[model samples]
Target: MSERVLIPRNRGFLFLDSHPAGCERLVTDMWQACPGSADMPEGDGPVALIIGSSAGYGLAATLAGLKRAGIRGIMVSFEKAPTERRTGTAGWYRTAATADIARAAGRDLVFLNGDAFSDTMKNQVADLIEQRFGGRLDYLIYSVAAPRRTDPATGTTYASVLKPIGRANRTKTLVFDGEGVPEVREVETGPAEGDDVEQTVAVMGGTDWERWIDQLVGRGLLADGFATAALSYIGSPLTAAIYRQGTIGTAKAHLEATARSLNERLGRTVGGRAVTSVNGAAVTQSSTAIPGIALYTGLLRGVLGEDLVPPVHQLAALWDQLTGAAPSDLDDEGRIRLDTWELTDDVQAAVAERWEAATTDSIADLADLAWFRSEVQRLYGFSVPGIDYAAAVATDIPWPDHTA
Candidate 1:
């Protein structure tokens, strides 16, 4: 392998490249940030699988499961591999770093790279479970985020849209030029046209999750007492027009409905269950691309301050819930409400006030804009504090030991 210096460059709001050492630093930082499972009443024989276990909440949940639960784990994600001319995805580096840490610690972990929405990927994971997990899985997490999905039955590709449902959406948003300061502007988006909501649901919703469950059940891959969680987000009213009550929200509603249906079916058939873990907002690849989400999350961080529950912490707590340490804080809809901190009366009042008064000059004061930008870069392994960007490091880190 050849070594090269990684200089971070921003293409629009996304990073053009990722640093391997920086990604390793980030994984190490997350390992330290997560709560240890020393006091928890943990159950044994946990063979866990995270469907989108390379970045964002999936990666966080994977870390929580590994460090706290010490379970045999399998990860599934789709990311481009690195070539001689360019670095691969941040997820590729993150997964490589995760595998490195797991190996050093003697942890049981596996990684598979492929389109998770496809039946082929499901079959491959089933085969892995049979070969590596004694033919049964105890825990499953559905946390995939994608721009589009091709239906296996019909081979129709559906692309998700982030538009409002009923009326035009006009909201305050930020545009980063990768310079000294960001420009805050008003963005107007039209409502979802014909088939937009359906397409969004097909890409971002829970049909794939249900399909995974059905396929695993059909193969007898899920163990008795199996539990699965699908991560969901119902954003604040600040971005509600474009998020919670919009096309994406419609898709999330479908996801919640699928969870309810799957929960009942799993309970009836295998004495198992499924639930949607409604998590707090954080800087993730999926959330950063949404128009108004940047402004909303910045204000959320500003108002909540130290009180804000980071996504990894929320996921670690979810692990505690799944492993019998704590009971779930479920809502009337039977969904685990991990977003209570973000939805509190005081927090919302402050965030709304900040949102209303925000402008190009005042937005930074109203929200942690610098931190938000840093976080976005950190996701792609660029803005990590300790990594030496000037030093040359190997970019072609091989994928973890697993079938791709």
Candidate 2:
């Protein structure tokens, strides 16, 4: 006889509202919904800041680092979907949920509803640091994943053009159109070379990351012994053309190189180090969108859950390194081989080989399919516990009281 709970934001769609307070409540709800065991452990001296702490792997990074490393710091994100004029965006709810969780834990959490790529938001974060917490941060995470960006000065738009590296590379990916597993065929390779590569780099590359660091340091807001890191990925050669060697790959290369440069600059003031983490492929919203990623992720998920650690766990290990408990050798060129344990040379080679041999007539492991389905569902905020799904809920949201 319970009433149904009505979520403010629509399910399965990315939405945003300008209200920061409601967004914070949504975040709290999300945190409560997650299984308690899902939280990573926090070591001593937990002080961290997470940029782009909203969805996908970015949210995982925030939770893992905070729970494991004990970093109870602020979170900043640039979610441009819902405004007060257009309430009930996914970000607004996510922010609301985040605030609730932080309050319960006696931790500090701040959600900035502006463009992370802009100097204005950066300035706001700087001012907040000065006014509230004495301008000191131990750990900084750069985990923004956007498909496009516009040059504030030139007014030119840059986007990540999904393309193949060399010639037209055709491959078979998983087709989930049906309830059963099927192999789908793709052709015409991907985006053309030259301009495609440059455009992709411009859109997804390291410029924004560099600017963030610059703003924090320039404002004298960064604390001593600061450590910063960004996430990256490298999949098998099947989609290498479209992923690693393609447009997105070029941007990642830029990011990898930029980390070293930023580390050197930050070394002077904060004696800080820049790290690049090669995260595992989880069933995140972004991963689902990438071409040829679902099948690989699905097959690897079951295998990883058995033998290897998950991406969240990998994040926890990385947090240990950031806090000086673990050695840097745990990572590679700022890239942590999170999937290496599960996707061992033997494991990955086997998956690639099986995928090549797999035909539409072939039957995949039923268990793998089920795991994939569950993971995808978990990504969308479904299957969450605690809240009464059938309870009558009000759609009205409380307005945010952002100081800035």
Candidate 3:
């Protein structure tokens, strides 16, 4: 292993590298923040298969499951490993670090890294379920967010785009590049073109999720009372045109529909339940890329200030409801809503005022751009407080070696 002082390779909100030690520290922090006894609880331990369990809500839900419910987890994800001169993806290090923490707490966490959209990966997880989990699953969380996906049957690739549905809209967006002040610029987002919506749906939709359930149920791997959730976002009206009313919205709608379909099948057969958990907007890799999201989330964070609930805590609350520790918050459409606090009228009113008041010079003051930028850095294990960037550190960190 080579030791070198490493810094962030950042371009605006996009980070190209992740710090291994920093990522480990993040995992440790989240683990400590989680509520539950560290010791694995008694009884036949619950089992979960979290697809895309590396970063964002997926990682949060993964930690919530392990620490809150004492679940033995099988996390499926795709992340690049570090090379000699370059750092691995944040999700890569996070998964490894999580495995380390889980092992220390005497929990079972098996991580399978590969293309999650592939049938090969499904077969791999299925084999593990049969061999290691006694062919039973208590929960299945799908939190995959990818730009493109290849159809396993047709050998076709579908790519998702961030665009409005019918009419293009112009909006002010916030962008952070390096240590400089965040840039506020007006940009016109175009409408989705031919096949754009369908392709986006194909990549980001519920078909893959349905396929996973179908396979598991067909194999009799789902336990009685089995429950599943796919993470989703229905943004504020400010972004409704570009997000909730856009191509991504179409995909998420499909996902929610899949949940209902699966709910029927599961309820009829194994007394299981399935639903989409509509999460609140925050600084995530996907959110930063969307044209107006950075500005919106920044203002939202600024207005909320100390009252802002981190995604992990919100997800922990979801965990509570999912396990029946509290009543499940189901909307008229029968989907769990984790964004209730974020989408309140008072909050939206404040955010809209700030949005109107924002300019290039006052953007930082009107919105929490600095905080949003820092959060993105933390996502990739950079800009974490207490980390000694001046000191040399190892970049070639190993993934936690384990097998079913």
Model 1 lDDT tens row, 238-300? 888888899889889999999999999999988988999999989898998888888888889
**288-354 per-residue lDDT for model 2 (tens digits):** 6667777667666544556545555667667767877677644446555565665468777767766
TM-score of predicted model 3?
Answer: 0.97
Give stretches of model 1 more than 4 Å off: 37-45
lDDT of each candidate versus the true structure: 0.87, 0.64, 0.87
TM-score of each: 0.96, 0.82, 0.97
Q: If ranked by lDDT, best first, what sequence of candidates would result?
A: 1, 3, 2
Relative to the true structure, candidate 2 reaches a TM of 0.82
Worst 10-residue lDDT window, candidate 1: 37-46
Off by over 4 Å in 2: 1-47, 80-91, 178-183, 330-334, 384-404
List candidate 3 stretches off by more than 4 Å: none
34 in model 2: Cα distance from truth in Å? Answer: 10
Task: Please give, for residues 41-61, the per-residue lDDT of candidate 3 as tens digits.
Answer: 676468999998899889999
